[model samples]
Target: MDARFLGIPELVEVPDVAVVVDVMRAFTVAAWAFAQGAERIVLAGSPDEALALKARHPGAVALKDGAPAPGFDAVNSPGRLRSVDLGGRTVVQKTTAGTVGALAVKEASLVLCAGFVVAEATARLLRTRGCDGVTFVVTGEDGQADEDLACAQYIARRAAGTETDPAGYLHRAGASRAAAELTQGVRQGVHPDDVALCLELDRFPFALVAAVEEGLMVLRPHAVPSPIEGPSPIDGRPL
Candidate 1:
């Protein structure tokens, strides 16, 4: 299996499998929402589109970040989403980085939204599906985003049959400028617990796969066991 990494803007051509990562914290929020029992998530390119999707779907909830759209149900933060009951409800998500990056890769046959929360499951699913090649798309700043880059590298290492420890990569991401800004509470609408939530490695045992259905990028979780021997430990808890 071969793996290549690129930023969203660098994606001139995408491979069979595309793993788009947004660790701080779009994909993380999506993973948490799925863990909270969301039925499905629709990725929108803009806030207007997300609102429209929610309106069309009736029960769908819209989530977004930056310059709060009047119709959005809430901000895209895993910390805040943890308390909301999304059980069996569809989510319409429009983020500045994550969703846009996933939609940009129009050439990829398969698109997966990834973050630390679902990194291991994503790698295991890729292996199980016998994908010959994979592309990791870092969605922040066309690849300059440290947190996203670190996540892409971690997933790449795991997919390559390496028994890697996530601490090192997590540390790198934690020290990034984005993390620092979020830590200092400078980013508006981002919850204080969002950084910690986003950094939880392998917290979910499912891969969030995106497929183009009816001209929309719809994401759904697929369960996949860890590639490693035992359940991966997270914050003294077994996943």
Candidate 2:
């Protein structure tokens, strides 16, 4: 299958399948939440929409830039996900780029969320789904962030039946100028821990299937063939 990367605005039309990537935080957090038993995540194009969705659900969790909104259960941090119980719960997720980009693709045959955690599972599904082509939407600030681009490239390579040490993708992305900026720490308004969590390749074995439901883009876990690495107390195994 042919795979390519496109920025949000550059995508004039959808392809056979569209995989939206947000390696810096958004998708990475979603993968972790699902791993911890989140039933589904609802993606909103804007914060107002997310709040409105929460209003409809009453107790549903809402997040902004990965942090928990008031009255929400938890934030978007993978680390925080480990401390909470999301089993059978629905998550309302709103982000600056990832969710918005995924929802904007009104014509894609299939939409999936991608990052290093679910990259392997997503690639396998892309190939097995009999898609003629796959487009990876890299949600970059200037429509070009290294981390997002690296994730898209990683998925593209995997779909083509090629190999690249997934860790290498993290190394390159971590050193990128965009990612570098986040490393400045929370004092600078960037959470380094969150960024570190995004780099954990293959940390989960489930891919998120995106679909429009009740006017919201819902992302549900599509389990792979195996349990992957079951989260272990020692080191969070089987990713």
Best by lDDT: 1
Residue 28 miss distance in model 1 (angstroms): 0.3
Candidate-wise lDDT, in order: 0.85, 0.75
lDDT of 2: 0.75
Q: How do the residues 13-123 of candidate 2 rate in per-residue lDDT, one tens digit apiece?
A: 767689998886788888877776777788877778888888887567777674445655555566556667777777888777888788878467799888888888888
Local lDDT at 162 for model 1: 86
TM-score for predicted model 1 compared with the true structure: 0.92
lDDT string, candidate 1, 1-239, tens digits? 68887887788865678999999989999998887778889999888888889999978999997545588887888988999999889999988899989998855788888999999888887777777789889888778988888998998888877899889899989998879988887776788899999999888888888888888889888777554545332222221
TM-score (all chains, Cα) for each model: 0.92, 0.86
lDDT of 1: 0.85
TM-score: which candidate is best? 1
| C-alpha positional error of residue 127 in candidate 1 after TM-score superposition, expressed in Å | 1.1
Worst 10 residues of 2 by lDDT: 230-239
